[model samples]
Target: MDVRTDEIAEQIYRVSVFVPHAGGGAGFTFNHFLIAGDEPLLFHCGLRKMFPIVSGAIRAIMPTDRIRWLSFGHFEADECGSMNDWLAAAPHAEIMHGVMGCRISIADMADRAPRSLANGEVVDIGGKRIRYIDTPHVPHGWDAGVIYEEVTKTLFCGDLFARLGDGPALTESDIVEPAMIAEDFFNLTSLGPTTAPNIRGLAALKPKTLAIMHGSSFSGDAEGAIHSLADHFEARLRMALR
Candidate 1:
């Protein structure tokens, strides 16, 4: 599957879409968010090659040098491998991650001390605000967390309600039935201890749209849909432990 990027918003942001061809047509999608601001923020930097993809997306949205924050969910390659590369590209962009991501990154990139983000901590992006919501075990990565923008009603969901598929749809209005999308979303839910509580933190924020790294994003009703996902995780967690 070819990775594609598009500017969907009213020129406020751009999404760098990555389609995983390894899924045998059951491909999955991932994204990195780009916007111009007093300091730009780039979410979910993809593979090594994706660095250029991210740069191009930013250039399309704002300018090649507009980024100021390069954030990721955890230390996963599908999400963060290009971070080091991003650091090199964007001189002013800071690498944002949780505790472990910082520790691991600091080991190699000692000069670049990442700003450790905790749940509910807000990072200023010019006039916009990006708050971190920690998700410990949605699929079992310790440093996993998500970023939410209150004013814009956007959630840079790490991997909370993910589905392994691909399409041109980028927002909620693009979907036919959102509930059906939720069902398929469960397909990506990792089987283990339930991670509902972690997801709940992000749910509480009432995000209008969720830019999930995999599958299509959740558009309208994002608040209720996210809570439902949180509920699903909690129930599964309870079931697993019992």
Candidate 2:
């Protein structure tokens, strides 16, 4: 299983690993985002089994030990499976997440003490400023949250735009429809009343690039894509209610 790396934005690198027969043979991609800076930040750590290759890919761009900040959307294996591995490798690295996540799981789960951020809290990691936004159960998981890089206007989409298949590293095309297909296939979202509203709030951020966790990363009309995705979920919720 080889991992591919691409610069989705200025200093933001997308590290992707494709599993040709995942999700009941529908195919899938797991992507991690690394923002290069004085205090380098890595978004997702992939699964624990993916540590070696994922770390190797990260090593190509910078020393694995140089990673100062570790973060993810939630406490899932795919999101922070390599949490301890990263902490062991990078002595200075510390896990960062929303207050609720830390209080609920990360505090006990992480080998090292983790830092919790209040909603809208910004951390300046040298060249980039990352703001943590609480998105509990937006897509799924009560510990769910996301990050936005103020410098590049890039939104780190956890499983929000998740899709099946190995697509390009980045695209300017419409991704909302493909995401909807995956949603139908997996039924991955929580589908609560707040799901669409939580997503619509993110649309207000006006992100320039979307660093998706699965499938392809998207550029161009990110806000439009986000709103469209939200509308789809809203419709789904209404149908379910009816």
Candidate 3:
């Protein structure tokens, strides 16, 4: 397992762990983002077993104890498996997630109470402000939601554009094809009626940077890429229903 860090966006760092042949012959990458701001935030905790690696990567930028916010798109092991570990490391850190995630899981699973954000709710972390967007069942989690950093126009979009292997830390290249390939193998999308609409809502943001969890973060024409994904999923759903 090789863990490395890169600054994918302004003040946003990506900590990626690459595991070769981990997913039954296909290699995989798990990513966590650290946003350095007034209240430093870490999005996605990686797996519990990888806490030392993730935490060490974080400590390289700032003291793990200085992390004020720990957040995720949904309640999953890769997303929040080290929730308690983080809470213990960062004494002042508080969990943040969508309202449903709070009610359904974080509230009970976290050692401390999580600050639940409703759709469109914004939390200011010094110079940067993050707005939460509810995206339930879009990527297969009922409590799923993504955050937009107002300053950088970066969307911390969890698994929306996930691809396989260890790709570039940040790329302006087209990721739609790779993402589609991963979708075929993982079938991570929900295919629900609301999925398309939810994706369209994210596209409306016109984000410049997409901070993904499972693979490389994407840059450039993020809105277009999102719409392309939405169209693909919508077509698949229509065909399946037919």
Clashing pairs in 1: 68-93, 172-219
RMSD of each: 3.4, 0.7, 0.8
Candidate 3: where is the Cα deviation over 4 Å? Answer: none
lDDT of 1 by residue, 1-242 (tens): 35466654433454646465644555666677664457777777777766676667566557655678888787778787777777777777678777765775534553367888866788778867888776665554766677777667778777665655666546665332343364454555554544555556565677667776666666788767766766665666677678
User: Considering TM-score, which of the candidate structures 1 and 3 is the better prediction for this target?
Assistant: 3
C-alpha displacement of 175 in model 1, angstroms?
8.6
**Model number with the top lDDT:** 2
Better of 1 and 3 by lDDT: 3
Counting clashing residue pairs in each candidate, in order, gives 2, 0, 0
- lDDT, candidate 2, residue 113? 88
Which parts of model 1 have CA positions greater than 4 angstroms off?
Answer: 8-12, 18-20, 104-111, 173-194, 238-242
After best superposition, candidate 2 residue 152: deviation in angstroms? 0.4
Model 2: how far is 132 from its true place, Å? 0.4
Each candidate structure's TM-score, on Cα atoms with residue i matched to residue i, is: 0.82, 0.99, 0.98
What's the lDDT for all of these models?
Answer: 0.65, 0.94, 0.91
Question: For model 3, what is the error of residue 106's alpha carbon versus the real structure, in angstroms, after optimal superposition?
Answer: 0.6
Model 1 clash tally, residue pairs: 2
